[model samples]
Target: MTATDLPAKPYRNTAFDASINNPSAYASTLDDSFAAIDWQASWLCHLNQLGYISKSISQLRGLKNDPAQTEKLEHTPDIIAKVLNTALQKHADALQQSLPQTKPALNNQAQTLKFVSQNELPEGEAYERFIGTTGNIPTRDNLHDLFNGSIWLTFPKTKALLNYYHMLEIKEQGIGASRGRVRDTITVFDENGAILVTAESSIGKALVDFDWQESLVAPRDKWDEPKQLNKQAQAAVYIFGHALLEKLLHPRKALCAHSIVINVTQDFFTLSLSERINHLDQKVADYMDALLSEPDVSPRKLSPLPILGVPHYWAENVQPSFYEDSQVFRSGRRSQS
Candidate 1:
């Protein structure tokens, strides 16, 4: 059978489900066992090898003991640079050994970056054509880049495929401030979790059929509450950019960032991690092909893609009701002027 025909597989959601009836039963699975020193050493070594000493160091500090530091670092690029450089000095010996030489060659690549899956490198001509540009690749020095790079390492194929489609759409439609098909394919994380809804899917007739606005606007304060947790998990697909895995653990009728929220059983996460990646990579590939092959295809016609973002990332001018507005949740009742 085709990949599309294959059953949905379970994956871990980084957002803890405090509502789970028996937390102890799943507690062991969440443990990463590494101490702070070990975690720092490991990341420093990895980033150094990749020539991202400063970025890795900054991320470790910003994310020192918690993964949620990403939101704080997002707005403080200056602080990130300062802390990262300090980290490089503090861990000089480890960084020196990780590098190929005492000094590495540098280039004039652009500072404004876009992330692509490093795992898919040594790519063919077709891949290059799809990408349309070079040097936009993200570096490890930035928290955003580091988080994105982690996503690539974990979901290489899926990330690569999304990049492929993103570039293709950009080539066809050209870039603009307005949201497009390519932009929808990604999901960014915020303080609460992954943000699933985008500008396009947040309004019009679609809003009424599904509780998309309500699902999207719920705050972190209510996330742990059973009803709200289920609501957020149902509407969301937590692809933790800071971590190595993506979460689509719970099933819901709500729209996901990329496609439908398939029914993935807990047994799915039981498989080896590699097996899980293979399963998801194939599923995404199949979905992309099916999506593109349809007649009269457009971003609006396809499943609402997710581009997850952090809190301040979306907090600027969003309607307060989206998160605080109770009126947006009303169904089947049109206002009488």
Candidate 2:
């Protein structure tokens, strides 16, 4: 046989494809439990060299707005107001185009960043009820950490828009957490970029639900019956959330789990999965232990499934669990006016 016609070499390794197949592998170190520390560091350095960190902040800044550091508070406030106003206007237009089912009236109030809605608001009153005072405006510090910058609006599919709005609510009012959307969305793309998978936010929220409970790795019993799955992740999986559809996009910056509660036992190490868990578990455990041992402090939750994953085998049994009266957006429904 000609050399050019020869079959490609077979790829073999002890590494499990589940973790590496995830997009989060390119963004964070949480999956390094089995990985050598040097290897993790080197890989992270390479990812950074590819401009992941800088690009993320740059995109986020564009989504929000950074008033260039100015010496005067007077000039800064006006600049900050203009920047935020611009973001609101752009988001408003995107929202108008997202839902074609309902006819929305363009309230003159959007230019001023007030709450307005259409009948098909996928996220409900969460954004409108966000507690921050509109007149207070946002601080320079707040502008720099804009969330949901990397996500794009896809018409007729309102989840992305709602998720982005959720990010805005959290940023504007400090109402909820802000790390999962990017990590989970990016993870999907990194793992199955070749496939055409559409991600719905309810599914992302289901992942966040698992994250909040520290129960991402559901035991096997939960998946045997499809009927038991929750409204979010079940649909996410059904829609092929595992496929990596946008791999060519720039990698996201690493996410860190913030303050969290913990109950570490000397025996807990024995409870871990044999080969599938990320080596970064120890670091996570350490952070949790530190927070739990401290007095007079609240721990912030971190995004799960970034570096490693929810442990695919463990997820085999997980069913989505939706809460009644929750503000989560279910698949289907968007209003364009």
Candidate 3:
């Protein structure tokens, strides 16, 4: 496959299909124009009648809908949030409660919690601990917090793990002015992380080396991989940070991802969308575990991805000249190319 032939979306939920009975909308594909699409309506319309979402997303289309509210989307932070759906905004508050506590590393059991005001957090109480022990994620009525809650639903394990680490750091350092390296790493990722998966290491290396032309344009077919099962695609980006997703709502070239790249196995290409999400979540969690284990591993290290540069993610990326804008696809830390 060539660049033009690259798959539009790596995981499933590419667009409305025969399931929705609307071939025209299914054909437009919400992927074609990010800025032109309607977040409230057009986005929700493309889902597979009833579906789910994932953090790095075989599913952030992970979103399912109520037939009555097909056009309406509401935000509720409850684990039982199955009714309200538009763009993967469901089961946020309650998803955290359903977690199995994945490992002993975490001190608290994931259980039911109700949404409260952000102000409810005690002044000296660390935010992570408050959520860990009380099981309540004090939510504010805002997009940032709303996105944060929704991500919890998409990838509960990864989100819980992040919180555990944050709580651990806070306990050791007592929430000082300096959050230290671990918290900083978690914060950076939690705020702007995206999981970049490619079958070839060279593709990931090209991205980290700031070789935008090759990573983002060349070998584009690698990202799209030959489709199998009518849904499979090779490399993909599953947005982990709510902030990053919020930024994508407006869609700009300069926007970037603090990406962690994983060179996946061929089996990964064959798994269903939900399976892919679980795999990526575990991989990212393992990466975080490594960051905690080896001090010299550079917790601060993450590849910078000009997110829009992903093939077919942004309509403007179709032109070879799109990568020419040095402002977005800079060479490296050095200003000179």
C-alpha RMSD of each candidate structure in angstroms: 16.4, 22.0, 11.8
Overall lDDT per candidate, in order of appearance: 0.34, 0.25, 0.59
What TM-score, over all chains together, does every model reach? Answer: 0.36, 0.22, 0.68
Estimate, for each residue in 170-266, the C-alpha lDDT of model 2 and write its tens digit.
4555544553443333233322211101123333344444432223333322211222322223211111121111211222322112112222322
Candidate 3 local accuracy as lDDT? 0.59
Candidates 1 and 3 compared: the better one by lDDT is: 3
- Candidate 3 residue runs with Cα over 4 Å from true position: 1-37, 40-120, 225-232, 297-299, 334-337
**C-alpha lDDT of residue 72 in model 3:** 42
Q: Give lDDT tens digits, candidate 3, residues 7-48.
A: 222112222222223322211112222233234321121122
Ranking by TM-score: 3, 1, 2
Which residue segments of model 2 deviate by more than 4 Å?
1-78, 94-137, 141-145, 148-303, 307-337
Better of 1 and 2 by lDDT: 1
Q: Per-residue CA lDDT of candidate 1, range 298-318, in tens? A: 444333322221122233214
Best by lDDT: 3
